[model samples]
Target: MVGWVDRANSKRAHTLAQIPHEWIDPNVINEMKERGYVNTREYLDSVLPQNEVRITALTATELIERIRTRKLTSFEVCYAFCHRAALVHQILNCCMEIFFDDALNKARELDNHLVTTGKVLGPLHGLPFSLKDQVNLPGIDTTIGYISRVGHKAVKRSLLAKVLENAGAVFFVKTTVPTAMLASETVSSLHGRTLNALNLNFSSGGSSGGEGSLIGARGSPLGVGTDIGGSIRIPAAFQGLYGLRPSHGRIPYMDVTNSYEGQELIPSVIGPMGSSIQDLELFAKLVIDSESWNYDPQLVALPWREVPHVKKDKLRFGLMVSDKLVMPHPPVLRALMETCEALRRCGHEIVEWNFPHNKRMIDVGEQVYAADFYDEVQEILETTGEPISEYMKIARENISYKGHSGRALGVSQWWEISREIRSLKEQFLEYWEKTRDLTSDGKPIDAIICPAWPSAGFRDGDVEFGCENYTVPFNVLDYSCVVLPVTQVDSAKDIPDASHSPFSTEDKKIHEYYKPEMFSGMPVCVQVVCKRLEEEKALAIAAVIEGCLANVEKL
Candidate 1:
């Protein structure tokens, strides 16, 4: 049998070969290579046909309305996204699989249905949807960066996939992920590395990096991503996209392939990623409205709640500048502060808040995620003898408490850890409730604004350079979190402070990584979080913050 490396190469070659010749532009490839970093939006604007540009620019909501009104056909919408996605893959290496012909055909059928019947198909009719490699689609391989699983076809589709199809959504491509889905950066033996579309020098955050890159590049309006330890939010923050990580059981996780399938200490949840808050809400409401619990036993039967509109004058927000574990880099700190100021100027109340035992929370997350001592990752690597990617090695060294040879936790120790997690959750909720005394109206804070990461986006292979204390705490607490992009990295304005002291060794390393010249032009985003199972409130608050920022820009 041929070696796994050869198999991986063949798989990549096959994906590239599938792209039509007409879509392959030699000049674009040369331009991407000649310039180490090329912004996809500007590049595509200069080259793509006017019609394709206009079609792809429409938000999911706008596109659906147009299709319903018969101003634009489904074929036109799907074709535009497919063509742009093909280009995105060529430059960003984001897609692991592409089937534009299948997508186009599906679009044509939807258009025909619209013509024959006066009724609109569904809320997502004719929308072009992207998927993370972990999500299964029929007749496609959900390799998820594993070389051994490269050629194996998925016999069935994930529940989310079926739900989208039933709602008149068209699937065309699956984005890349890290090996075993364990790393923060998207790189693997199978698909190489998916780079940031905004700047090639930095990483597209992972394990949902592919989805982040594609959507950030405006190749797709909305996509699906999963998160355990900030997987979905990390990519969204780095790529300057809006993403929501709902509480566990809110969205169905059934029939999805994962690395550590049995671990429930910190259950992974799937949610939507998109360019706008409306897109995020639209996709999430559609899925919840479908009553996913009927199809997946794992889902909670919580229907999407329509959040009552809150006046900015009455809304209170908790501002967390530092998690006390690691202070964010200058750009992230500036973004947080600016967002707070904008909210305050809009008549919102801002209260300083801090949670207890953040470091211990990180410890709990690491132990739970690595509870099996990475045996699953080892077994998958051994199946094909594929070498671990450098980023994965970095992640293992930094996060894994025991060395590579350590044993799994015993049953008694596992139970103790579980109890500790339960206690921590209760304590966190109590603290949140206590905020009522600090707020202006004697009500708990509506949401908290914090840094999504220590930096906007880090250089490739610097995976262990920053602490995810901001995003991971919510995961452990099972609270609903949304990432909202606030600003881009500005070199002149976001310069490092020489007087800031590092909190720990990890903090020192992350501080050193924050050179203004290196991260200029990257997107800076903040995390907005609410109580557990409060997705509706979290999303509305995010929308409020987004609108406030837009008004600030107008000034």
Candidate 2:
């Protein structure tokens, strides 16, 4: 990989230097105005009164119940969601494209089906869901952050979209992603930046940022997003939503636009995001139980297992105070401490486990993330003569700073590293298995708790030294991980303890940014991680933690 890197670097010298600085072509902007794609100000003025229905953030199950009982028509539900989503896009720049008319028409048909047949189409019938732009929809442009793809459209819908459509879930709009879907902050030449809904000044987190902002704002009840690095989980964490970066292959990835098309050493997974965990589970089961594998051959055929019957009293958990790579920010640290305390008070055994080699896992994750030389990314950008967006350029530099030795491992070194990674997996599992003998019930931990990211959401462009490895390492191990927002940054309590001093310059910088004033009110989250393919167990554990927090709030 290193050798290829030096060769690739010598192969090109900041070619983005030649491109113009503006976001889009003036002609394209003019053409958009001519085609009625102008600013939302004029449109919203005429369309404001029509936005009468504003639905609260309800779960799919609740929405389905309402639709079935005739309290809410399918058309009304879809329309309400579309109207709010358009308003969200206007403020946050979330949607890459909107299809309110088509979505409302589908909702009408679904309502008629329910009325005539006296039966809903599926569990998700009439519920509105959003998608990350990479997921294709027939006849809808899927410009996954490329200028040239502005008018691009797919001939067929992606398997995920098709599955949702068949299940009667209405999609009114597709959200934006960073160019190449590589950056943590969402911005693209095609649609510009997607800001956080909670505080427009802060990042929503990406490449699923737009979806995060939309869901965070209650514009949509549920959304589908793809995760490579911290794509789904990061945004979900930032926006205080529940997001699952399921084990790779558990969900289909077929037909999605990828930053690295064929680099398969570390694979990306598509997963559900929503305002609540139950909704996350509902969507997860709805899609998986639909036997999605039949359509997307790449998807694992694993059906959603029934919720495991596990008693909290009998359950054991492993807890890590820190990954020991980059320490989490003070607010994040406080949340972890609070969570551990809450779980302990709940009568669950919490065993401390630390893995020193975690930084190595993070290293390997990054190596694989950029393994493609980003060839496909540059090619995609060049296609439209679109200047690489600031986010992508920044991402490329961050990846470059890892200092590729300008050396590639021989076939033998590659095998050695692969073997080492496999060995590490077993080693980690061994540590886990040993917990069974020492824990209260002599049972292995049901799940392990850890920080989702170093901080709630770092300042834009502040990811020069990426801490995404905290989440991405799970991706490498294919561990099932879920992000749960447990607490908000409390200016009074989340203050930094700089007296201890920094371990490195970067560590100091990380610490320095934890000023209560800067991070106040950002959602501080934790991740529930379980062994590979143990999503059911992981989610159950997440629920346990969530319950503990709720109980504490009651007190």
Candidate 3:
């Protein structure tokens, strides 16, 4: 006896009564099914090993060894990873798109090539990898979380993708990001939010949050992430994985999509992320050594060098446990203390480092980053009709409304600010050089140990969280930074000292927001940083820290 309008309203009310409706529109579901990917179970079974096989935690190195020894075929390895990636996406919302068919097909081709040639196609042959939604893969959509770009596929591959494909690496999937790819957390109108693997209630750091979550869950052996600010390092640290924001120009950026289409003063760099330093080194060495410069003119001509020069007995290090602007949370503080103690036990000299000029660096970087007034960024948002992500709302407060400043600054102001930044960089470098005279053997400090952020994996939509500038300072200096997981958060010890005072209003908010129970079991990490163009040395130092901590963990 109900009228049609009344029945329609009843259905609508019922839908809203539950958790947000995840309706797969009939047209979209049909398209997915037609492509043979809507139900991943059958495809996964045909291409992957069974669930009981214990293939989840294997590193890229171990997988390659298994493939080399003929204990596992390339097809089987790729299959296991694709299946795992599908499962991870289901739970974490980490994947932007799945490409099992292409990856499996590529794996079979690698197997045949190995049989005929008696040699692997390249270092990463048959390795399954995921890319940040921003990186372009040929014939795959790189919408970057915007509905406007949803069906727009790349005509050519990104430099990194091309390099990996040429190395016979199987690119199975791409992951999600914020709408403009500028937020501190990943959530988009297109693919939705990516959740933390350790706890679903927390955020995976963005704009590479999906990559961070996917790689952290062991869904992909490795991934490619880009950073201009703390994009790559923050996510990796939150996820307890290794990530690098190499010196500008270290990795080529051709065919990649970005919010700042033409802003070049502080150009973003593409880098690799993995669960271990060894895996990171493998990807970096193979990709750079492939001479990708021939395809991307922007790439520096630096070849990857497996340098053997981390002398543990003679290394001197500067430690920045807390930035003046924001004191790190108790867990991060404990990790720094633990790391310092471990280094001292290993005979490495540590020098106290307190940087007061960190604020200026943050200010300058913010100005330069927002110099275009966010014109291109605003345009992208307007085109997609998606609301700004929360992290970006904070950045917009510092930049302009509508998400950017469209006006240009006077030439004189621009020139003066540029000089100020140059002076700051020179001053930092000088301060670092002075450490050489303080060293036992008069050698410059090999690297600096600093907190990657103020805290580990924050609760979802934590806009008031501050202290991310720790990683941003290195980016301002144009130096390379590698994130290494130091320990796991323990609620019993990481509780807040409510009786103590805060450094600032933002600092207080961040401090008061800490709930030990909420963040328990999340990984605590730090940044290992070196001068520009010292990637090889920086990574080697990171490896030393990783090895040192691993040794401590065993005891």
Candidate 4:
């Protein structure tokens, strides 16, 4: 039998061979590998035809409008994205599956329907949509970067995929993910590592890194990613996109392949990633409008609600600079402070928020995430005799004891952990309620602004598991969180603080990783979090913040 590495290499070669020769640019490939970084958006602008570039840059809503007006046919929009996605695959290794022929055929059918009936198909008519490898599509294998799952085609489409397809989304490709979708970086024994489109040396941020990198590079305007612990938000933050990890019941998760399907203490939720806040809102509203609960009993029956328009002066925000577990690096700190200043100048009130028990919440969250000690992952690997990828090994180094498993807790112990999770949520709610006293308006803050991660983006395989202090707590509390890009890392302005003191060993390690030169061009984003299941309001508030920043930039 061939070794797993050889098989994995062969699989990657097959994927590369699928890209049409016309899209392959040897000069761009050599240039990207030589410089350790490449601005893909700029490179594509110079290489791709002017028409293709213009078509692919349009947002999802814009594409739908043009298709409806007969200004652009569905086939034209689909072909543009398919061509660009092929180039993205060659440069970044972000694609796991490509089916452009099928995509074009569907686009032609949509165009024929529109021309004959003179009626639009659906809200997302003719829009090119990408998916993470975990999302099941008919006649395609959702390997999700697992060598063992290779060649095992999905028998049916996942509920989310079906709904999106019904709503007129063209599925041309599925993006790469880390093995088991458990790591913060996108890599696997089967598909290899996915490089950041902005800087090849740094990570794209996973387990949804592929979606982030592709969208960031302008390959696709919209995509879907799942989050249990910051999977969606981290990738969006790293790539400077808008992502929402809605509370568990807001979106459907039926028939999705996952490592540990039984673990529901901190259940993973499906959400959307897009280039703009409007795209995010459209995705959530469309999915909710589908009434997914009818197909998946696990989903809540709540219909999409209208987002209340809160005036800038009426908005109250809590500013959390540090969680005391891991202080954000200077670039991330600057992004937070800059966002706060923009909001404050626009008449929003900002209050200091100190949440010391966030560390405890993260601890309980990890316990819930790894309750099975990765027995399921080992089982899958054993079936194909594939060695674990280096990224996954590094992610589990601190927790796993032996090669196959970690210490699994008993039922009673699991129950104890669940109770602790519930207790922490209650305590945090009380803390938020107490904030009513701190604000001048005498009400709890509408949302909190905090760092998405310690630094802008980490080098591949360098991400520590528990360092996501700001993001994981919301996941633990099942709160609605939106990641909004605020600024890019400016080396001169975001220099390290010389008088800073480390809070712990992890904090010291993170502080030492902050080299301004390494992260200079990467994006720095902040997370805006609201109470549980308040996705509509959270998205509206995020839009307000984004608008305020844009207005400030105009000055």
Candidate 5:
């Protein structure tokens, strides 16, 4: 019988072996080692062949449009992204499974179909995409970074995978997730830690860390990630990518394995992590247009709404700079302020808002997330005599940082928690509607713009570095949110508030860790959140915010 160590090493070896030696550039590897901060896409351009970089750099929309016009072949786009993914995995340890040969073959078939039938496969025809580790593909291991599940192969494709494949999307790699997919940092005893490619010393953010790092570095054009408590938004924000955290059942979660699978109170939701808001909308539209709800009864029967003007140009946005628990680092605050100013300059309304239910939300989240006391996680580790990851341990241990126990809450206990959360949801909804009175058109603010994390990206192994107070409330309410990349850390302008005192121990720990020099140039973003099941409106506002940020960059 293979022990956990051998099993883990074997899995890592298999992933590395999948990348051809020709794709490995030792010089680039050496350059990365010598440096800490790198503009990953820019660095790749200097090291990789111009044609490959050019093709890999194209967004999913551009790649498909070019392939449709015959300006580029599906084969070329697939090979380009697969190669870039290879290099990125070698550098960042983001990829867990790589199937380049299969992807290339599919790409060739797609090109031939276009030639013979003069028709593309579907909306996403010939576009290359990546997957989060838990998403199943037949014959692939969906261990999701657990050694015990290493050799077990998935016999069927996840429903989401099938939907995308049928739409002409080619998949070549599966990204990483933390143990039990619970940690904000992606580190597993099976595949090791996924580092931020932008700054090798910083965390990539998880459990979608692999998807974030790969897409952030331009290794994959678009990817799908699951979010329960900011899993999608955290990595997307840390790596400076646009991500969607849809309301439960908005996207099919059936056929995918997850922690506490039966827990539907704040069940994990899947959404897109991509280069642009358009790609997120595209992925959502394609999946929903197929009426995926028919295949997965858990899905919402919400069809894609074509709202050319979902909201007015003069929008009202609730600005949340701090959660009153963990204040953001200087760069993050700068990014939030910059975004606020940019929106205001565009004639949009900005109103400062504070959260009164965050502490309650955090406590409920802890009770729900760790209610089982990690029994499943401990059992999985014991099976192979594998030690639990340090990040996971630290995260679980910190559940009491708020002076509450996360022990198993029996059905009745959780029922009360669920009931409390639902009531809070009603109260929050009331607050949302009351904001309409604060608006010129008597409509609630289009979305709430706020910082995603305390820092741009925490240092590697800095798992206990930040609080999820800002992100947890939305998950508690099941609101649709999108991460909007605004700016990167600037050492010159972002200095610490050394004179400020801490509000709590968690605040002190997070505050003490902020160093302009350490996190310099790291990507910083703010999440744009809309009401429940309002993804179209969220994305629309997010696009506007994205545009405002772009204009800020121009200045």
Candidate 6:
């Protein structure tokens, strides 16, 4: 009686047989499946080695400053990012659970406690962090892409994986997610579509699409994902990396696992992705220096607060180009107007945001996220008749098939959709405090510049229009955004706008699912945001607009 397609092909062959057979290469994965396996960092620079691709291109604060100065050895940066996350999860099926001998026996006990106490057991000392299959890792199996949560084992361990294993890091792997991580597009019948570690025919943006295709293919350098709407900034803006969505209680979702598992009306926090923006503020400053709200009493003792620099031509951002409902495409609106006119020619002050509370916070966040209508994941897929994934039956036929299963929403209609989500967060904090009389020096505009997804990645069933018109009104105004990775998909400078105009029918299915040379080189992100608990001023305005998006995408 085993067939949820034989338990999703034995949970994807026990996650590529936990990847350690000397990092398999069946002839460089059969010559990139005969020349069609579109680059996962050139198939991990043709199968790792070269010092495991320079220790998986170090960056979890450069593998914790060369493993705290002894020139690297937390068992050589956790056996070179667990052998480049076991050869990029044996070809971008971006890992779900691969222990690598339990992260090389916890990086040889943090290299025997930093060679017997020469110090460094905390600030992520051994560095190798990755986790998104909904965090939890007692004995593994956070089957978030649930075939009724196969083999089920997370008995304990998930308070952000025991605060990044009590901050000396090194967790090997655990990435992919979609099923009950509830779709952005990480596909699943257990793990069939994680791809795009840089254009494997586009889309590695999920429910933290396997920590954005394993740290956008450097395979684990910094990881932690979960974003309510933009699942950790649409897989770190579809694998160009540098994510974070922190706000709801400022990081710490307690014992994790969520597919609306107790949907706190747009909750889901936990942040960080990769390709360093200083390891996305070193994984939100080691989970706010583990004052993790005095051990997760639903976090917010809010420390690690150092966001004081503001002189990049006296800040003032606000931009929001087009949430007039999905317009961006043309290399994601030319990487947001060439990184907002190169951060206004390296002086900043962009203004124009006006966000009249995005259609009543998307009409009270789609009736308080479908008022518990996902019926405990369709009653655990009709009591385990399981096997579900045409991208979750196209997200239950694009949400209109909600025939009320476990039926929720009636504590006086969920307290009147929680007073219309607290009056759309007080009309989005009175339109972000009246954008300080339209900024320039007014303060109410240090961050906003939008577009996390209009088009930069999409292909696999394109999850039937789901990036909720630009990262779900900051997950219904819990704000504190951050997506970064500014430019790509240029097809000789991203064209497509044969004089257009649509704004509906999902903006003409995103302008016929855009095609400047068919998403030429993918990755083109943006989203800074801020406010609500302002994650260190939205990652310090995405590290100064990624240092002026590398000299404005070289013009």
lDDT of 1 by residue, 1-555 (tens): 879889989999899877899998756757865654368866776678999999888888899999999999999999889999989888889999999999999999998899898877889999999999998887899998899998799988899888888998999899999998877889998888888878877789888999999998889989999999899999999899999999998887888989887788799999999988999899888889999898788788998888766633468988999988788989999998899888887889899889878877888887787777777887898889988677656556755544423568899988998998999999888888999999878999888889888898888767666456787788899999999899989999998988988887778878888889888888999999999998888899999998888888889
| lDDT pick, better of 1 and 2 | 1
Ranking by TM-score: 1, 5, 4, 3, 2, 6
Candidate scoring better on lDDT of 3 and 5: 5
Tell me which residue pairs clash in candidate 4: none
Error of 2 at 177 (Å): 0.4
After TM-score superposition, what is the CA distance of residue 100 in candidate 2 from its true location, in Å? 0.3
Candidate 1: segments with Cα more than 4 A from true spot:
33-37, 311-313, 399-405
> Cα lDDT of all candidates, in order?
0.86, 0.75, 0.76, 0.85, 0.86, 0.77
Estimate the TM-score of every prediction: 0.97, 0.87, 0.88, 0.96, 0.96, 0.35
Tens digit of per-residue lDDT, candidate 4, span 1-555: 777777788778777776777776757778755654377766776778999999988888788889999999999999999899888888888999888888999999999989999987888888999999889987788887788777788987899998899999999889999889987788777887788877777788889989988988889989999998899999998888899999999998999888688788899998999888889999999999999899898888999888566643478899999998788899988898889889987889899999879878877777776777766787788877887766555556655532325667888988898899889988999999999999897999999988888889898667563366777899899999999889899999989987889998878888988899888889888999999989998999999998889889998
Candidate 5 regions with alpha-carbon error over 4 angstroms: 25-28, 35-39, 400-406, 440-442, 552-555
Regions of model 4 farther than 4 Å from truth: 25-27, 33-37, 311-313, 400-405, 464-466
- The true-versus-predicted C-alpha distance at residue 393 of model 2, in Å, is 4.4
**Higher-TM-score candidate among 4 and 6?**
4
The residue-by-residue lDDT of candidate 3 on 369-454, one tens digit each, is: 76756566667667645565566667767566333344655677678768988988998999898888777888889899998888
Query: How accurate locally is residue 292 in candidate 6, as Cα lDDT from 0 to 100?
Result: 74
**Cα lDDT, model 1, residue 189:** 87
Higher-scoring candidate on lDDT, 3 or 4: 4
**Maximum-TM-score candidate:** 1
lDDT of 2 by residue, 1-555 (tens): 223334223212221121223321324323434656333223333344543333444666788788889988988888677766656665666777677778888899999999899998988889888999889988777767766565567887788888888888888878888877888888765566777767655787988988898888777889988888889999999888899988876777778877667666678888998877788877777778878788776677787886657434556777777775567888888898889888877887788877667877777776676555465777766654557656556655655777644334456655665776787788778988888876877788888888888887876556554468578778778889999999999999876786756666766667667678877878888999998877777777788889888888888
* Higher-lDDT candidate of 2 and 6: 6
